[model samples]
Each structure stands twice: as structure tokens, then as C-alpha cells.
Target chain A: MDTKLAMHTKNLNFFYGDFQALFDVSLDFGANEVTALIGPSGCGKSTLLRCLNRMNDLIPETRSEGEIYFRDQPIHGQEVDPVEVRRQVGMVFQKPNPFPKTIYENIAWGARINGYRGDMDELVETSLKKCALWDEVKEKLKQNALGLSGGQQQRLCIARTIAVEPDVILMDEPTSALDPISTAKIEDLITELRKRYTIIIVTHNMQQAGRVSEKTAFFLNGVIIEAGLTSDIFFNPKEERTEAYISGRFG
Target chain B: MSASYTGQKSYYGDGMAQNIARRRRHGRVWHILFYAATTISILALIVLLLNIFNAVFGFVLIEDEVPPTELAPGGDLESLSQGELISLLEEYLSVGLIRRFNFEEPLAERSVTDLAALVQVRIVNPTVIEAWSLQESLFQSDMIRAEHAAHPGTRVQFRSWLSARFLVSPQNPRPQLAGIRTAFFGSLWMIIIVIVVAFPIGVAAAIYLEEYARSEIWYNRIIEVNIYNLAGIPSIIFGLLGLAVFVRALEPFTSGTVFGGVDPTTANGRTIISAGLTLSLLILPIIIINSREAIKAVPSSLRESSYGLGATKWQTIWHHVLPASFDRILTGTILAISRAIGETAPLVVVGASTFITVDPKTLFSKFTTLPIQIYQWSARPQSQFRNVAAAAIVVLLVLMLSMNAVAIIMRNRISKQRRI
Candidate 1:
């Protein structure tokens, strides 16, 4: 494995108003590798994913105490622009939400707003092709994005995010709202994306975490229980809680 | 298990059939009540429409000072063009009457249609001696003829009060010569200014309140509550506000004196500009509340998605929020404008003229809206004036409905283009 680091959080603490949501959570994500955060509902896995892009700033009275570094640069530094950080780290939400615009515009708007000065048609095509959606949607690029099925819409959202050329893509339960067929397609796409972009995914399905990620971190009660290689964590968990959760004894 | 079985058996035995019947009876009662309410509203609307239509068309006894054949050179007044009509007016009408008509607007500047209208209204001078409701005119022809015979000089003929001449001519002391042209132009001008002034400002205020202002702040809460209350405030109160501010305090600007006065004699701040600004204030709260609701209807997911794509807040609102809610905003605008069009108390307080003969030429000119004209006519002692007012009501209704239709069509087109 390559030794280059992509992102790392050191003792990250997050609070929604006065209620602490994430406590003493630390983990490392390597470049060009898929890292999965797995936990039950309200376990703060999604919260931590949002923290990487500073998306929690949108919620009122949310405060974070800790340090997150991206490519060795302090992402949460006072001088750092959240907009620039978000541009470098794009996101796909749990439910697929494409803009209520045409398919071409769904991909083009992000690039245009980020000051991309290239052949827009070419960029749209490349982004769509990378998500494995070009062949399905190429004939109707000008149609409204809302016309696509759920799985295709999620892929379109991914293409829209990558159109801005982000270094890291954060996906929060991207396949939960989709059917089995769509879930399989997204898993295959995620595995293929691991070679080019650093991927961080928050998921509730332990099997999905084992299937797509090279490294897996198990979260419970707003705290990281264990972190290691995917095979080591699933086959030989060091913690009893991790082992219990993986074996479906309790969430 | 025995105790639970006993409880269930006792519950089921307690008039189960009666309970279902009682529930069905209650639902039937509610259904009857709702149906009765709808019927009452529909019946009221129908009665109102019938009353207006009754006055619009009927039998009338007309008496002309000079018959059409005597006034026109070829005994066919309808065949005359602008030049011929002007010459005929000059030849037949008194020099004093020609001078009066010219003083209102130059004869040379008037179009062919205007000149022809002048011939019918000024030269022939036909007067409506007696009028009958549509029901009486249709059912009692012998009675009408006998009544016409009693008035030997009058001729009996069915007349529609809402006619081409009624739309073109200006108000006259004689009910037969009165028309709504001035009031229509006044309303058209006022509404144009209202849309221009209120639409953008209302939309901007809505965006600021909904998108930027934090609801937790005390002042933002105050603004929100105030807007809700303002929408409920009596329109007459807004009229009083307009009189105090636009008509009196800001007279110089409202009268266009600040911009080098065009008509200093008539520019007394009771002009179209003042009325338009007053109406704008009257509907601003409505526009704001409706637009706020529309903008609020845009899903938070859309905003989050835009933000997640590295787009700024303004960009998110512009690219996604505004377009998605544009049709709803237009619907709100149409409602606000409709309210502004029908408003009379506010315009009356702001000094709309009751008997203006000249059409409004600019924002600085004194004006009278359709509702004000109807109000003035209906207040008169003469029964004939009431008939004219009824005709005016028909015009006003048609105008309002057409405006709403245009706005709805525009909204539909935009929505269709963005259809998923």
C-alpha cells in the first residue's frame, strides 16, 4: 500500500448546541483508497462525514473542537475558507438529490460556479462516463434530472460532484434509498472510483463496508470503537462491541 | 388469557352495531353541512351576476336632438372617415361646442376612431329617455311600446349599455353620454406602476426575510409577526396612510414637481403616481407573505444539495430556489395585483377624481380608477346612473379576469418548460 495520507482527524469533538454528538473520534483515510465508517442510527458516523467538509456550519449553534487535516493542510483552521474546502471535498447525501435542472446542467452548474474554463460538453461527458451513467443518459442529456430513476439520480449526483474535480468524495449512505440492483451498481462504481479519488463512506450495512472499503472504522455512541484493515476488523475484531455489532447481536 | 378474553368479549357486546351506525350518521351530518355551505356561496354568486347582467342590456327610449341622417352629408354617419367626421362636426356643431371639444384634446391629433366617436357623442347628441331591465324588455314588449307611445318624441329600441361608444367616450353630465375610457386608462397606468414598484421590492424583501434573516433574532421575529399582521390590516387604513404620506408629505415627488413639472395646475400629488404608490404599499405585505410562503416551499434538500456542491448561498437561491418557486411567486403577485385593481376606498382617500373628463396623460396627471368611477356613479340620485355603474362593473370584472388569465398562462408556460 502507498504510504501517502489523504485526510486525518485528531481527537475530533462535535456538539449540536450544548449536546455533544461526537467525542474523541480519530481516524486516518489514505489517498486513493476507500474508507468506510459503519455504525447504527444516531451513532455520529454521518455527523463525522459532514464534519470533513464543514457542512455542519449550516446548522445553527453547531460547534466543533478538534483538528482535521486534508493533504496535510488544516481544514478547520481559522484562515481556511469553508467554500474552498467544500470545493476540494464534494459530497453525496443519503437520498439522491439532483438539482431540478436538466441532466447536462446538473453536471455543468458545479463546474461553472467553481470557475471551470474548459469545454463544458467534454467535462460533462467525462464526469458522466466516470460514474457509468453516460451510456444510459447520453441520449437525453437535456432532459430534467428528476426524470431519472433513483439509482441513476444518485449516479448523476456523483457525476455532478466530481465535475468540479474534487480530491475527496464523501458519500453518506448513498445506496440506502435504492433497490438491490441499484445498490450493486453503486457498489461496483465505488470500487472502481477507489483508484482515482479518496473515498469516505458512512454506511449502516456491515457487509457493504466489507465489500467496498480497504479500511473500516466502527463507531458506537459517538465514539470510534476500533479501526483497522477491512479483513482484520471483520475476521478478527479487537473489541467485543465491534464483534457483537458485526455478528448482528445488536446495532 | 381468561381476563383478556373476558374484556374483549364485553367490549364487542357493548352496542357494536349502534356505534357503527352513529359514526356513519355523524359523517353524513358533516357532509350535509359542507354541501349546504357550498350551495349558499354559489347561489349568492349567481344572484350577483344576474343583477349586473339585468342592467347591462335592455329596452331604452332614445331622443336625439338631430337625427343621423340630418347630421351626415350622405345620411350614413358610419361611412365617414376622420377628415369627413371632423368637417361634419365643424359644420353642424356650434363653434362654442367645437372649441370646448378641441380644448380637451386637439381635433387634428385625434385618430379616425376618436373622430367618429365624437360625431356620435357630440354632433348627433342622442339621449336615453327611459331604460328597462333585460327581463322587462324581453317579456313585456306591448307595455314598452305603450310607454314609448306616451312619450311621443322618443323612439323605442333595445340598447346595450356596454357598447363600443360606452368604452370610448368620456364622462358627461348626461348618463347617455358617459363612458369609462378615462377611468380605464387611469387604472391601467396605476396598475402598471404598482407592478413595476411592488413586484421586485416585494420579492427582494421576501428573499431577505426567508433566506438571510435568522428567526431566532428578536427583530426578525418582530418583522415576521408584523408582516403577518400587516396582511390582515384593513385596506382603508392603508388608504389613510397613503393620504398622509404619499399625498401630503411627499407631494413634491408624487406630483412630479421634483422632476420639472409637466402639468403644474393639475399636479397636486393626487395623481396616478400617488395612487400607484399608495396601492403598492397596500399590497406589499400581501406580496411579501405570499412570496415568503412560496420561497419557503422550496425543499431544504435543494438548498443543501447546492451548498454541498461548493455553491454560495446566493448562488443556491438564484440557481435553484428562485426558479423552482417562480410560478408560485407569480401566483402571489397576481393575487396582490388583483386586490390592488379592485381597491376603491384607498384611492378615494388618496383623491381619485369623481368626474374627470380627460384621460390620464402621465404619472403626474390626476386619475380615477374603475372602482372609483363605479362608486361615484352608484352614489348618484339618478336611476340612470345606477345602470351606467352596473355596466362599469361588468367592464371591471372582465378586465380583472383577463389580467388573471394572462398571469396564469404565463405561469403555466414557465412551469411546463421546467416540467419533470
Candidate 2:
């Protein structure tokens, strides 16, 4: 475990209108490592991921109390733009959603909007190649993204995120919508990605958390029940709820 | 369940089979009913089209005292030039008649077609003694020949009430030379103005209402409900609104007086500009409602994707939302313009001149649209006028259908460009 932290949350609470969804969730993501947020449905794992980059602000009447910090400074502090924060911390959704545009444009749009003044063609190519999609889509770069398959579209979304060179990637169930073969490909890609950027993935699959993540956090009822090394959380008993959730006794 | 079904089969005496048969019978009944309904609708449309076409073409019993061929140097007067026709008119007509012709569009300045028409009307003096509808000409031709044999010359041919001459000539009280040129241009002017004034504004308002306005807010809800209600209101009411607003209050602008083009005495605002602005008002609510539906149909996930990439609200709307919805917005606009093109009551309340000889060449020109011309001609007591109105109806139908086809082609091109 490296003591260097990429991002961390301190006693974060979130509300949708009057209903609180996340309560007192504090966790640290190690620099250049993958951390998995494993929880059942309605356990607030995705909600916390959205809060990290202020995506929660898009939902009306949702409020975030407490703080989220990238490096050492709070992301919500005065004079920090949400747009600038999101530029550094990008997100990949549960379902693959690519803009209804050319596959090349889909990856280049983030960079273009964020004022990336460089070789756009090279950026698109490198981003696609980095996500292992360039070989499959090299010939059809100008074709619409919606024509791609589900797995290809998911990979394109990841490529789109990395095109802006974000420091952290927030993936909400990146493989939950994919088939077995696509899921295996993404898990393998995540292992390769861990060397360059910090990754936080929220998933329902406990085995996915065990396979790809160095640190695993178990969430139950809007609160983190246990957070530790993957081996300790999977094999050693810290909380009965953590063991019961991992072993499939009960969620 | 299998054992229960086996036991119950005899208990109810084949009730399961009877129930299935009953359901099948119900399905058959609905299917036949739906089939008959569609057939009736198509049959009604066919009947309507046949009736219009019947009036549009047919036979005419033409009688001329000294036939046109006898007066012209060549048998075909139509092949002559304007100068040659003027010379022929001078050779045939007396000094008094030639003087009267000079009071109107000078014969030298008139088109060759118009001069030839003048010769046929005055010197050749042909009169339509009798006429038959298209249906009669095609089916009862022998009876028509026998019936009109008593008349002089029986100079009857399959004369189309709608002709190339009818399309190019100006509106004449005589249906023989009545043309839709002026009204066609006026309608075209009206549609251009409507598209110009309504499209960008309607789409902007729709985007604001759908993308920016909070639906739960009081003012936004009020605006939304009012727009929906406005779409359903009678077009005549919009005519009245336009009369009060654009026709009266904005008279200086609508009459082109503000542009310093028209004389104040003539700028009463019942001009083409007024009609166009009124029609734009009538079509706006429809365009806005349709555009809102189009913008709404853009999946929210697309917006989320844009936002997740750190794009602002306007950026998301402009980059992703607007482009994806452009095709549908164009469709809505086409439909709205179609409705505006066929509108009569609004143009009527806007004070379209019932009989305007001059084509609408400027915004200040007095105008009459196709539907207005159709309405005016159809109301006349003369049968010829009614037939001519039917011709106008055919032109109007073609205009609308062609407009729809053109718009649909544009939409398909966009779809192919964005094909998934």
C-alpha cells in the first residue's frame, strides 16, 4: 500500500431532495492504483462516484455536505471550477453512451471543448490505440459511433475519457452491461491502466472487485461497512457484513 | 396444471377449446373491421381526387365568327412574336379598339402570349357555347358529339381548363385566361417570410423551454401550457391577433413605410408583408410545439455524456443535442409551413385583396394566396369560375405534395449522413 493518495473524501454526505442517499462515506484512493466500490443496489456507490467530480450538481435539489479532495485541496473550495475539476477527473458510465457522431469525433470532442490545441488526429489515434480499439476501428474513423457494437462502444467511451489526459477515471459499473468476453477484456485493460492513472470502479460483481482492485470497499445501506486490502476484505473477517456479502451468504 | 387441465377438460365440456375459438373469432372480427375502415378511407380519397380532376380537364364548344387562322398570316398565331402580333392587331382592329388597347398594358410591351390572347378575345371573338366535364369527355364522347352537332363548327376538342396559358396569364374575370401566376408568387412570398421569421425564433424558444426552463417553475409551466393551448386554437383567432398587432400596431413596419419605399397614402398595412407576418404568427405555436417534441426526444443520456465530459449546458445543447434533433425539427417546420400554405381564414382576416391583377413583387404589394384565390373563384355563381377554382385546387395540391417530398428528401439525406 503506497501512502501517497491520489484522491480522498472526508465525511461526505449526499442528498437527493430531502432523501439522504450517502452518509458519512470517507475513503482514500491510492495513487496509480485501482480501488473498487462493491455494494448491492441502492447502496450509494454510484452516487459517491458522481459526487467526486461534482456530477451530482447536475441533478436538481441534490446537495453534497462535507468535502472531496484531489491531491490535497478540496474540489468544492471557492475559485475551483467544476468544469476544470471534471477535466481532470473524467467518468465512464454503466451503459456505453457515445455521441451520435463520427468515432474519431467522439474521442476528439472532449479535447476540442477543453481547448486542447494539438495534433487532434494524433490524439484520436493514440487514445483509440491506448484503449485497444484502434485496430478494430482504424478504417472506420469517420463513421458514426452508434454503429459500433456494445463492447466497442464501451471501449470508445473509455478512449474518449482518456483523450483529455485526465488524472483520475471514475467508472460506474463499466463491465456490468457487457458480456463475459467483453468483461474479461475490460478487467484486463483495467490492470494495464493501473500503472498510469488512478481508477475507482463501482460494481455489483464482488469477483470483479477481487480480480482487478488493490483496495476494496464494501458499502451497505449508504455507508461503508469495511475498507481494506482486497485479500483482507475477501479472506479475513473484519465485519460480518463484509464477509457475508463477499461469500454470497447475503448482500 | 397438466393434470388439472386434463381433468377440467371434461368437467366443462371443451370449455378451453371454446374459449380459444371465441378469442380467435374476436381477432378476426377486429381484423376485418380495420381492413374495411382503411378501404373506406382510401375509397373516399379516390372519389375526392376524381371529382377535382373531372373539373380540371374536358371538352369546350368553341365558336368563332372568322376563326383565328383566317386572320393570321401563318395558321399558328402562337408562333408569332410580340411585335408581329402588335402589327397583326393594328391590321385587324379599328382605330378606336387599338386606342382602347393602348390604355392598358401596351400591345408592344405585352408578351406574345398575352397579345395572341387579346387577338383571340377581340378580333377572333371565340365564345365557349358549351362544355363537358372530363368524365363526360372520356366516357360519353359520342353523346357529346351528337348533342353539340347542332352548334356551329362543333369546334370541340379535349380542352383542359387548366393550361400552360392558365398558369402564366394574370387573373382575368374570364375563366379562359385566368392564371395563378400572381397568387402563386404571393403564396411563395408568404411562405418565405413565414420560414424566415418563424424558424429560428421558434426553434430558439423550443430549445429554451425544453432544455433550460425548469418544468416545475410557475412561469415555465404557464408558458408550456399556453403554447400547447395556442397550437389548438382556431387559425382565425391568430388572424385577429395579427390584425391587431402586425396589421395595426406595426403598420409602419409591415406596410414597408418604415423602409421609406411606399407612399403613406397607400401604406394601410393590408399588404403582402402584413399577410406574411400574420401567417408566421399563425404557424409559430405549431413549429414551437413540434420543435419542443423534437428536442425532447433527444435522449437524456446524450446530455449526461456531454456534461460528464465537462461541457457546459449550452455546449451540450449546441454540440450534441441540436445536431441530433435537427432532422426532426426540419420535419416539424415542413409540416407547419404546409399548414400555413393552405391557410385561407388567416389570409382573409388579414385583408387579402379578392382581385389583384399585379403580382406581388415587393413586401408592400397587395397580395392573394392560392387558397384565397381558390376560395374567391369557387364562390362565384358561374360554372366556368367553379371549374377554374378546381384547377387552382390541383395546383395547390401539387405545391403541398412537392413541398412535402422535397422536405422528406432533405430529411432522408440527413438521416443517411447520420446512419447508425
Candidate 3:
């Protein structure tokens, strides 16, 4: 019923075959703000992020219950198409996965396939510029994207996601595989991206959550332990388990 | 277990040095065993290639019934033009023989080589008195000449059976005039048909199995198992299947009767089309298995990213999965094609004409592939036919190697363009 919210989930439960990966979980993401999901390994942050875009549908026998909404529309409705939901809500993976194509093509392919009829060159340049990769890759836009460094390739992936101009961007550990400098660059890019799009990022680093997120949700055993202001979650949490996880007492 | 000593040796313990020496001796034995295995494989290949080459190039002593010098205007058969050679054929050969030659093809339209072969077979009637391999010809030329001196009017010449004339003339009873022109075209047409019929169907089946089919489905699992097992089935069994289906059941289509091409001379389903389809059946399972493996080798991450970008399964496969696996698919196709080209049993059962001298002008025409030609020649009673079969083997190997080389070049170019 929160019309102003960019997206919200209502009692979402997910399963990989018979084994449950997510409990009945409800969460909301504000428009043009960053929300961080912090959890230990196998705690289901990535699974939940994937569920938002129905990316989990690609895995065989994996199922999700309950509802996910984008703006006012229910994404999990029978009439709703997964492709359309994913087009509106783009995703950035944990590792850079650029298409085996030129840098320009990597940014243009998603938009082109989604029926983007704009000037492709302008779109590629703007996407790269948004990710702050234009200056570095402008001279070699026609070169293979895989030939780039890990950080640059990740930036290219981000640029590729934003090229389609989605309303929300889901990043599952966007900088988890990068070095410190590249991580800093991505954190800054997140700050810049937050001004235009709602970002829901899954991260293992609590400091990153405190640094970039307006709101933080802590996950434990496929369940949402507590969610509140990032400052409060880091400073003072309502749940003892949330505090225990935040203070690094145990996973 | 804890004892140690050191000087020149880094370390030593109770029974450790003896144990190490024994282990090293065992290692040496295994090493020599592996090395011998590799050497045997290499030596076997070298011997096979050497035998083919030795048979392909050699020397022959020939005695012409009528010397070519008397037939040629100036006793130089090589200098005579096509018209003159045809005139010579018309002048000397009987009308029945000329008509038989013309029935295969028009004499006027035939190449000079064909006219010369006719003169040799009908007029000069050259027969191989004796043949010697390159090794014999090089090492014992004097002994060979003296051994064959009893044969009157015999001329000794170095004759590489794989010559230009051998490539152009049609099959003949006389080994001196026999050529691979008919068999070459037959093989070419058969291979083209195989590629056209097999590549697309095989790749599509592979894509379906790799991308769409569910492992949990009963029929899919059965199909998967069948494909793998089909790859190991004896090719002769495929020939029997082809004989039953392509040669008999689909006789009308295979014989070109459905297309209104009815030839009274050899009106049967043992045509190029039937043989091609038969060979296609023999290699289809192999192509499918290889293509599926290629499709499977594409990284899961690339596919995941495509799906995450909202690409439909087909769109993702068309744009990403197929391109990433292009090189491997081509490699598999090349392997399948090489196997098909050298396939003999299926075509033999599909009824390749052993004495087929006419070039296959259409798919419905009588056909014989290179391997079939080799089989036919080697099985003949004549010693010269067996030697020429060696030459045919050389041709087959060259064709296979060249095709593989072209495919490898294409695969390299594509893989360089996309290394995913």
C-alpha cells in the first residue's frame, strides 16, 4: 500500500527444490536511495536479490512464494512477465560478466534487445560516462570488453546495466571481487547512482553498508533479523542477533 | 620415523634412501613404458604414411600393342592436340568401342587427357609389364631393368600413379588409362550433400538437447543415451539401415524418380543422393554429440548474465551461447565430415557402383567416393589396381587433412574474435 516506495516484498519465501533458502521475509526499498543487505555466506542475501528480478527462475526446480512489487505493480503476478520486470529492474553481478564483444557492444546489447531505438553511440558513451569508464575506455570502445582489467570490466558491466535506463539496480556484492581502489571507485559510483535510481546491494562488508546505504537489513539463517537506519543498525540494533552479527560476535 | 642425517645428501632416515631408490626405479620403469607406447604410435603412423607414398610414386615398364610413336604424327604423343587425339581414336578404335566411350561422355567434349587415355587403351593398348616401388627403383634400377629385359618393346619410365592424367581420365579396365575423375566428383557431391543435410539438423538437435531439454524428462534421457550409443555403433550397421531405408524404402526419391529423372542405364536408388544420405546417417550422431559438448562448454556465468539482462532463453542463446561455442562447433563438424568422407561400408551397402566410369552430373547419378574407389581398386585381382588403391589412399588423406586445416583456420579466427 506504500505508493511512494519504489519496490516492496510481502512475506517472500524461496526454495531451491525442497530445501528452503529464504523464510517469510518482507522488505521495502525507497525511491532514489540505496539499501544494503548484509549477511554471512549462505545467509540468502544474493538469493533474495535474485528473487526480485526473477533471476532465480533460470535455476531448475527453484521456486519462490509470496509477492514482490515494483512501484505499485505486483511483479509476482501471473500476468506479469519476468522479462519486463527484469528490464525495469536491471542487475549487476558479483563478478564482472561482460559479453565477449566490443566495449561499445557490451553497453548497447541489452538496450538494443529491449527495443531501445535511440542513437546507440550516444547511449554507450553516456552509460560509460555514468560509470566513469568513458575517459578510460573511450579510445578503445571497439576493443573486446574481456581484455579490460577486473575493475574496468565491472564498471563496464555496470554501464551495460544502466544503459537500458532501468528504474532500480540490484547489485549482489558488486565490489566483493575487486581490490581496495576498485572497491572505493565502485562505492563512489554507488553514491552517484543513488541520486537517480534505487539501489539494493548485497555486501559482506559491514563498513561498506555503513558507508553507502541509507537503510540496512541484516540477515541470519535466511531470515531478516532487523532492518533500520544504517547508522542505527551499526550503532544500536533492536535485535540481539542483529547486534551480535554487527559486532562480529558470530556469523 | 624421526631419524635423520645430512651431508651431501639433503636428508636421510631409516630405510628412506632404500625406499626412495626403489620408488625411483619403479618410476623409471613406468616412464620407459609410457615412452615406448608413444614411440610405437608415432612409428606406426610413419609406416602407414610411408607405405602409401611408396605405392603412390614408382616406376613401371610398359609394352604397347601398337607403339604410341607410330600413332602420333611425329612419334610424340604428348605434343598431339585434343582433336588429333580424337582423330587417332576414331581412326584406330572399333566403332563399338568408340560408341562405348561416347556413351560415357561425348568424345569431342572430353578433355585431351581423356582422348589420350582412349588412344592408350584402344589403340596403343599399353599394359603394365612390371612395376617397382620408389625404394626399389632408387636402390636397384639395374637389376629391375635386367629382370624385365625379356619382355620385348618394353619401355622403362618413372610413373607416379598420382599424375595429372590419373586425375582426369575416367575408370578403365587398363590400369594405365584409369583415372579418378568420376570417383572424385562422386565424393565431392556426396560430401556436399552430407554437410547440407547434417550440419543444421545436428546443431539444432544439439541446441535443443543442451539448452531446452530437461534431464528429468524420460524421453529426453532416452534420447541422450541413444545419441551417445549411436556414436559407437558399427558404421556397417548404418549401411544396412541405409540399404533398407534410403536404397529400398525411399527408392523413388533416392532414384530421382520422384523428381522425374529416370535413367534406364542405372535406374536404381544406389545413386549419389542415397549414398550421401546413408553417410549422413552414419555421422549424424557423432556431429550431434560433439555439438552438444561444445554448447555445454560455454561458461554458465555468461548465460546467467544474459538472463539477468532480461534476455529470453532463445535471445540469450542466439546472441551469446552460440557465439561463444562457435569454434568448438566448427571443430566438431570438421571431425564429423572427415569421418564421413572416409566412410566406406555405408556407401558400399548403399550400392556404390564399382565400375562407375561416368561422372555424377546429378545426385541421382551412380556414385563412388574416394574410399569406395580405394576399396574397389584394392579388391581387384590386378596388382596394378592394388598399387593405384594406395594412390587413392594418399588422395583421401590429403583431402581429409586439407579440409581439417581449413576448419582449424576458421576456428582460430572465430576464437580470436571471441575468447569467452
Candidate 4:
């Protein structure tokens, strides 16, 4: 594995109010590669993904201990603006949340906020094309995003996230709500995404983890049990618990 | 095994069917109760509306002389036209009841009821003018000319009950003629001033509370709670506050040379600005509460999506939240204004006059609203004045009803647009 790290976490812990969620855990994501975090519900996989850009700060009760770094720069440092961090590490939520605005404006909102005064039309078109949603939505760019189907909305969200030209894209169960065909389309988009930017996805489907990701980390009870190349994690697991889970013994 | 067999038989047989039938009977009883409750509420509303209609459209009675040959014992003048009534009044009534009314004094200043009492006395006692008309009729014996010569005073002076001319003309000190033109104009000015001062401030406060304020401090919480409580406070209390604040404290600024040097206090104790401010305070809470509800009704997902695209908080609220909520805010403002228009207690507490002869031309000028005018005329002891009061009440009700109807139409338009 070429372990040139894109993002690294060191002894990170998180809490929602008084209840601690993520225990002391460390992980590394490689540059230009897809990293998948697989865990059951409430195992802190999404929490860990959110910590990358400090999106968890939006929650009033959420608190964290230890440190996170992007390209060796501490993301949680007081001097670092969360807005700037979020700009660089964009996120796509599990549920498709499209703005009640025009499709074109939805993509342009990010660029405009970051003071991108250049070719807005070109940028919107390019971003939509990158998400593989251009042809489907091209003719009605001025129409409301709500008019799109769920699959189309999800893809539009992805396009909106990438429009800001973020260095890293963090997706939380990106295809969990999609139909099979949309899921396949997203899997293809994710493969294409890794060629230009670092990708981190949290998902439950083992096949998705195997298909799109180069590296896999399996979390259980807020602890990372095993992580290695995707093939090794799936086909020839190191831990007995990993084997039991992969074989469907129990979550 | 025997118990299980018994249970299975009950579940599979007529016993279960009987239980289902009993439940269905209970459901029917509930449905009947729900429908009965609905019908009772609607029936009550209909009864109240009927009461309002009865009070507004009741008959107007005017007294006149009935020719002895055509006279019924208790005569109502419903059958007489303008020409016949003029001839009859000229026959019996004298100048004592036939004096012309000025039609320019404030209805409050002149006691129309007392004047009506005086007319009733003259109706019973014929003056010299009546005797002269009767003698002139006996000599002429040309029936039409005799009728005219007999009641010459009535031909020149009698105003049939409350006519449309009374509404179109200004109120008079004379017992025969008075109208509500000045009072209507005063209310128009008050409403205009209230809308001008209240809308921007109310909407701005709502926007700040709903969109701008970030800290969850106890002070902001208290402000929120106080605003809600203010919405429920009595309008009369706000009138007292406005009297103290706008009339007394801010008197110099409001009633100074800019207001044409009119004293902050009038004989009636109400200025246009004072009445307007009182009404504004009365409706401010309503406007704020409605606007907040409108802003809050905008979907949370819309805001989240805007933020997810790196839009700032202001940008998200401005570009998406406000536009989505604008129609609702406009509808709410119309409702608030309509409520302000119908309020009588606060205007009364502020001492608005029922008898202002001049139309209000400035915010600081003295004014009278419609309800006050109606109240003044209704209090008069004269039966004719009562008819005039009923007519005024109809006008006031029509104005308020039209405003409320406009509010409903605006709300409907907003809802229709929102549906798509």
C-alpha cells in the first residue's frame, strides 16, 4: 500500500453531551484513494467521518478530545477556521438534501460564497458533469432542485459538494437510500472521484466496501478492530471477529 | 389443551364477530359526537352573524302628520314618498318643529336626542305657523295647494328620517341634519399613520428575533416570552401606555410646529398620532408573532442545503428563507392591520372624539374613529338619532367586513401559490 497519508487521526475521542461515542482511535487515509469505514449502527463511524472537517461542531452537545490532521496541519486547532476547513473537506449527507432553489444556483452557491466571481455557468456545468448528472438535469438547470427524483437529488448534492473544489470528499452512506441502478452509478462516480481527490466513505454494504475502496477499516463498539487492504480485509481476514462478522455470525 | 381449543373456537366463530360488532357501535357513537360538536360550533357562528345583520339593517321611523281622512290610529310613515310627506308635514307641524339644521357641527357637540325630544313636544302643540297653514288651507280649498299652504314650514324645513344625504354630508348641530363624513376622514388618517409607523418596525423585530439573534441567553428568552405575553395583553392597557408615552413624553416632537402647533391634548383627549400609536402598539405583538411563525414555517431542509453548499448564515436566510416566507408575512400583516382597524377599546381609552367637525389633516390633529362615532350617536336619547346610529353601524361593519375579506383573499392567494 502506498501510505502517503491524506488525513490522519491520533487518539481521537468524541462525546454527545455526557455520553462518549468514539473511543481512543487512530486511522490514516491515503492520498487519491478511496477509504471505507464499515460499522454497525451507533459504532461512531459517521462521527469519525464528521470529525475530518469538524462538521460535528454544529451539534451543541458534541465535544471531542485529541487531534485530527489534514496533510499534517491540525484541523481542530483554534486558529483554523471551521468554515475554511469545511471548504477544503466537503461532505455529502446520508439522506439526499437538495436546496429549494434552481439546480444551477444550488451548484453556484458554494462557488459564490467562497468568492468565486469567475465563469459560474461553466463551473456549474462542469461540476454537474463530474457527478454524472449533467445530461439528466442539463435542460432544466433553472428549475427547482426539489423537482428532481431522489436519485437525482443525491447526485446533485454530490455535484454541489464538489463545486467548491474541495481537496477531500467525505460521504456518509452515500448510496444507502438509493436504488440499485443509482447505487451502481454512484459507485462508478466514486471510482472516478478518487482519480482527482481523496475519498472517504462510511457504508454498511460489504460489497460496496470491496468494490470502491482500496483500504477498509471495520469498527466495532467504537473501536477499530482491523484495517488493511480491501482484499485482505474481505478475503483473508486477520482477526477471528472480522471472520465472524464477514461470515455473518453476528454484527 | 382444552383451554386452547376453547380460545381457538372463540377466535374463529361468532363470538369474535359479536366483539367486532360492539366495537363498530362504539365507533359510530364517537362519529356522531364529533359531528354534533362541529354542527353546534357552526350554528353558533351563524347565530352571531345573524345578530349583527339584524342590528345593522333594522327599520328607520320618521314621524309625520296623517291626513284626518287617511289617518290610522298608530300611523307609520312607510307609505309616504318625498312629495306626499312634504305636503303632510306642511299641514300640521309648525316652525317649532320645522327649524333647519346647520349640518356642520360635530354630532357630539349637539344633543340630537334632546332636539328630537323638543320636536316631539312641538308635534303635540301646534305653533302659530301651524295655525296659519291650517287657515290658509281652509281658504284655498285647492287640495294640493291647500296641503302645501297648510304645512309651508314642513315644505321648507322637514328632513325625512335618516336619509343618505345625512351620511354624505357632515354632522350638524341642527336636530334635522347630521352626518359622519368628518369622523370617517379622521379614521382614514389614523389607519394610514398606524400602518406607516408599525409595519417596518414590527417586521424588522421579527427578522432579528427569528434570523439574526445567535446567543441563547436568558435575556433573549425573556424578550421572546414577553413578546408572546404582550400579544395577549388587553388593548386598553396599550392605549394607556400610548397616552403616557406618545402623548405626554413625546409631545414636543409629535405635536410641535411640525404638527402645526396643535396641543398634544385636545378637549376630547385624543390626537391622531396618539390614536395611531395606541393602535400600533395594540397590533405590534400580533404582527411579530405572525411574522415569526411565517419565518419558522420555512422548511429546515432548505436552510441546511443552502449551508451545505457553503452559503453563510445570512446568505441562506436572505436568499432562501425570506423569499419562501414573504407571502405568509404579507398575509399576516394584512390580518394584523384588519385587527387594528376594528379595535374600539384602545381608541376609546385614548379619548378619541365622536364629534370632530373637521377632518384630520395631520398625525397630531384631533380625530374620531368609526366605532366612537357610532357609540356617540347610539347614546343619544332621540329615536331618530338611534336610526342614524344604526346606519353608521352598518357603514362601520361594512368597512371592517371588507378589510377582513381582503385579508382572507390574500391568505388564500398565498396558500394557492404555496401548493405548487
User: How far off is residue A143 in model 4, in Å?
Assistant: 2.3
Error of 2 at B13 (Å): 10
lDDT per residue as tens, model 2, B1-420: 323544653444546777889999999999999999999999999999999999988888777766867866665778877788888789878989898889876777788788887877777876666778998888998988887887756488677878887888778887776899889999999999999999998999999998888887899999999998989999999899888987899888888888897788877888888888888888899999999999989988898788888888889999988988989999999999999999999889989999988998898888999999999999987777877899999999999999999999999998787777
Return the clash pairs for model 2, or none.
none
> Cα lDDT of model 3 overall?
0.89
Ranking by lDDT: 1, 3, 2, 4
Candidate 2 global CA lDDT score: 0.88
Q: Which whole-number lDDT from 0 to 100 does residue B41 have in model 3?
A: 100
lDDT of 1 by residue, B361-386 (tens): 88889899999999999998877888
lDDT tens per residue, model 1, A1-251: 36688999999999998899999988899999899999889999999999999999888788999899999899998899888899899999999999878999999999999899999999999999999999999999999999999999999999999999888999999999999999999999999888889999998888899999999999998999999899989999999999999999998
Of the candidates shown, which would achieve the greatest TM-score relative to the real structure? 2
Could you give the interface RMSD of candidate 4 in angstroms?
Answer: 2.6
DockQ of 4: 0.34
User: What is the DockQ for all candidates, taken in turn?
Assistant: 0.71, 0.72, 0.61, 0.34
Candidate 4: how many backbone clashes?
4
List candidate 3 stretches off by more than 4 Å: A1-3, B1-30, B68-75, B78-122, B264-266
- CA lDDT of A132 in candidate 2? 93
Best by DockQ: 2
The segments of candidate 4 whose C-alpha lies over 4 angstroms from its true place after superposition are A1-3, A239-251, B1-14, B62-197, B211-216, B256-269, B383-420
Looking at model 2, how many pairs of residues clash?
A: 0
